[model samples]
Target: MGEKSEIRMTNDKKRIVIIGGGFAGVQCAGTLSRGLARDQAEVVLFNDENHLVFSPLLAEVVGSSLSPLDVVVPLRQLLPDVLCRTETVRTIDLAASEIEYESDDGEIQRLGYHHLVIACGSVTNLNVVPGMADHAFPLKTVGDAVALRSHIMAQMERAEVCPHPERRRWLLTFIVVGGGFSGAEAAGEINDLVRSSARYFKNFHREDVRVTLIHSREQILPEISPDLRDFAGKKMEKAGVSLVLNARVASATPEGVGLQGGQFIHGGTIVCTVGSAPSPVVGRLAAPTEKGRLLTEPDMRLRDSKNVWAIGDCALIVNAHDGQPSPTTGQFAERQGTQCAQNIIRVLQGQATRPFSFSKLGELCSIGGHSAVADLFGFHLSGFFAWFVWRGVYLFKLPSWAHRFQVGFDWAWLLLFPRDLAHVRARPTDRVSHAHYQPGDFIIRQNDPPLNFYVIEQGEVEVVRSSPRDQNGEVIAVLGPGSFFGEKALLSNEPRVASVRARTPVEVLVMGKNVFTQISSTLTPLRDALAQALNRRRVDVWKDEPQAYELLKRTPLKELMEPVPQPLLKPTAALAEVGHAFVEHGNEFFYVSSDGQTLDGVVTITDLLRARAAGAAAQTPTNQFMTANPVALAADDDCAVASNVIRECRLKALPVVERKDTRKLVGCIRVRRLLAYVFKHAVIGAPDSCQARNQLAGGAGRGMDWNNPAS
Candidate 1:
């Protein structure tokens, strides 16, 4: 108790870490901050990039309708209170309750957490096709947009200087792969840009620029109905985009793309819109997964680690309504973020958490200016109507009201000015040296002082416990590739409880836990929980297996120790507004208690003001000024129940009481504590606090705000 007291004194506020700065991750951070209104919790957002890109509007950037700045929000500005880190997540060590990633300076870090929100988002899948990496540009990010724009413009310049007609034609050719939204939109917009810009080109005619869209599948816009696909294809054909169906490029080179049907298309520019895979971090967890996405229950929680959560493109969320996984889209991602936030709150409040349901409101695709196709609840529409709807929906969906106005202005001004062509490029970093370790490799010895955690790219390991009871060790569990060990000891300064021996030749990601804490503090909650859980125990043992999970199962939830209890009314109860209570010691205001509980006071900013307005001196009794009833809660409750009490009562804070004595009010548990609970765990449950300290020290908590109550 004394140790915990000292720990609490040093660290008063709860910390929450969000891993991605994308739509889902950002929304989670923002919502937690706003919904909770206290300084007891902090929220942090983490990402590899310092800016938040509206990926859905990447086509606009390529089309010159929006500049990178207009579509991107600097992390520091939007989330001033929330910490932000730009780093690439390499792996998730579920067993040790931490995440490992590389920082901007190339230093590896490990983040410990109590909860985890796997919202790393998706990346363009470029490894599937041979030569794609060397020959094609993917329109998934700002860099891709800039590269395509520069290449297209450069081609135009070269066409004017080239004397040979064939060379100029090849220079003007543009090939797009996948024919999906990204491919189709880029093809259409580039075609429009070239056709519109050709009037100013000295030698190139509009006919010189040829745009071709290649699809391996039979249809385009697979999200839409078959009829709509045909309509979209016809529309593209009319707009001068050559549609190639039922075939894929066998290989791509700087010279051109070779199709499977023995046909080769020569083009100076190739924009590939191949499909995306779940973030590589998802692939690093040894949990049940579908394809590259982490497998989550209907409630968007990991199957084995119930307290851990996976959302957005990184997770395979099973829809309870239909028993199918939700589609990976911006809309669904937004919804999942919101739902996950709510569930996190619910779990903290000791309430029943709900499963995630895919609510299909509508789907829209923009072919070009005022040219679009949309399905709003199965009502298909095309052309201008769809365009308006698309514009309005996206405009409203922008993160902030400021963004909506900016987008509106951009739309209006695009008609007057040509698309900006200033190029923004991200230089590639030096390649990392490949390190190898075979199965049965002794990466590290058990009980050695803290060091780095490893990310497994391949193979497996055995987690063995060698206690004094037996000279020979017993294998506790088998950890396959993607599973991480040795983090707990590094994270909490505790001795390793078990030995990890590679079962097969394996690839491992290694990083210092402190560096991770510094870089990813805000982006991960599981680390926070792990740290908290570790602190709860006096004698800690770091094991290679799922010790954290097992410990969580064993620990009984208890009411937090606090001040004397006083019962008050639930916030939801109807009451008349009254004047403030008399000010007392230390700027405190007194208010009436519920059911004639004299000691129970609802002292707040409002109560103090009412007394001053009435010119009541300090000598006046606080009883008359106090509200007749104030909200109250039981101490022996889960976070979910506490949250519901606040929501139901419609109050800012509630005085908590022991389950045996509801009339007695203990130390107050405000909405902020609940928010902190959510923020720290990234989910809802008890956490290992020691791991969190290492995560924090290691820079794993780069983006978390420990003081932000909303988090």
Candidate 2:
């Protein structure tokens, strides 16, 4: 154990690296600094952020019960003796006992560590429900809490100005999508703030504001006893918070959250207090992981590596006391961090290490109104007593006296006065989210109520509609950048009639209906533009795609095959006439037919490029360069075969014939429109493999250059 001790002591000091600045990381580093001799060892803490976030109070910040400054302390000020770095860790080489990180200036720096402590906390994940990440507010950090509060206050201001009662109601609606500690507390706080602030606005009534607490389980706060959980739930419900129990969030949109049942909870603001995903740093490690969280031994060391240890939300630590995986809550993480630090010290000093053990500190959640439910010290407490204990416990746990005092002052001010009603400006990127989708992915589906109005920032999407009798849909129009859709349903208060599928890899901005209506109500030109677009809605195809929504099979070509306008040219026609055909009809390929019923050859713009390259004038005959017996799509063939034909033949448009015998052209399908047709018919419920096939077909069809064959 002492072999590398001398070498590890850089400049006669052993180096220990601790990552993250959360409860686990900060406490571990602080404990290590005190335990290790200053001259014999060095404790280095690396965090992308400069301050350690007092996470328990983050929800309070949103409710305006706590000040922003009260929930975070500077890492440098808290641990003056420890070396602190505000840099992002890039990679870790466990075998070499080294970590590589990038400085703020983008320069890379490497440091060797004799022992490493990984306590990087979790990040908010909304992947459980579609569009949840883009639509829901998170309470994981101070920034998140601040942004949420700003949004809440802004909604109130908007409601005061809005004349429409429906719009005002949407603005005032707040939905918290978790029933556990964060969810219950956040929902309760939001309820109190919105309800109390109504008197300040003449247009706003107390009944206009709505707050709902949704949980998938039968009860909220499983950590506490049923009596406490029931008491807390009843208290919040009595405070005008709607309880949605035993309902999982199937999806989330800007306008609302969709329950697994046929229920849509409309809300302007959605706060998701669930789904804490493992940190990206933890994912990059070479060790084994259980669902992105690094798995650690009973002693807190990694499953395979001895030098590296992991704790906090990013690690799946099993408590030695219970012989069960440790809870990801802050208290458990903090205890794990302290024990891990002591073990590291013992191992380095050539002493036996002990497995991590800890007793439950019990659980508590403040459910607004200066009331809380707690199971502290095996004593079941409710109402003011529980609330008092809750505040005292968190206040005592603050990183520094300065934070505790600031928080205490804020708490005292909150009890005496109403919540501060000022809107704190936050960066747009903090609350607004953007997403990218590959071609063939469904951006929106039909029959779903429109919660968000979308604007295409890049790439294109096809508006698809299907007939009531037909399973597959038809592409009505191709929308490009600056194009917007899904507004018609939101405005009309109706479900979406057609699906919006990505025609290419697309990036789009989405806003809740409250925001959309707020902006549209003020801007006449934008409202008029949206109105004009909605007026052009073709309702026939909006009936929803039955064949493509969820199936894993490839949508057959026969299903989408339709006769496209095939502009024809005689064998004697020249590239000059073909150019005229291009102007008259946008289709690049023209059938060189002696008889209009049968196709003799195919002529494309590429034929002109080859003809010109060979010194033939623009007046060159269509037969000279037109591809003979071009591979065509059989009307009965599947899309996968058609994909192969277009790919192998380097053809942009394929001829769909009545049969192989007569060679009679039914219609021509261009690669561009053909992919759109396939995506419309097949993408709704198609498997990933089917989507991949159609996407590949779409790619093959897009790169064809009729104007310049070489391109």
Model 2: pairs clashing at backbone N, Cα or C within 3 Å: 255-451, 465-541, 466-541, 548-684, 548-685, 549-684, 549-685, 550-685, 551-685
lDDT, candidate 2, residue 575?
Answer: 74
Residue 643, model 2: Cα distance from true site in angstroms: 32
The sequence of per-residue lDDT tens digits that candidate 1 reaches over residues 1-711 is 011110111144545557788777877777767665446556656798998888878888777777666678787777666767777777777786666776556666676655567788888886666657655788888878766777777777778788778878988898988877777788878888877777787888888889898988898888888877888888888888899998888866555788987788888788888867767666666788787888887788888775578788788898877887888887788888888877876765578889998768877888764578888898998877787888898898776778889989998887687665444443433232223443444555455455556655555454555555644554333444444556567666766666666554445566666654553366566465445423322222222213332332232223333443322322222223222112223323333454444334565556546766887665555555554334344455444334433432345555554442234554565544444443454532345444432221221322111111011
Model-by-model lDDT, in order? 0.64, 0.76
Among these predictions, the greatest TM-score belongs to 2
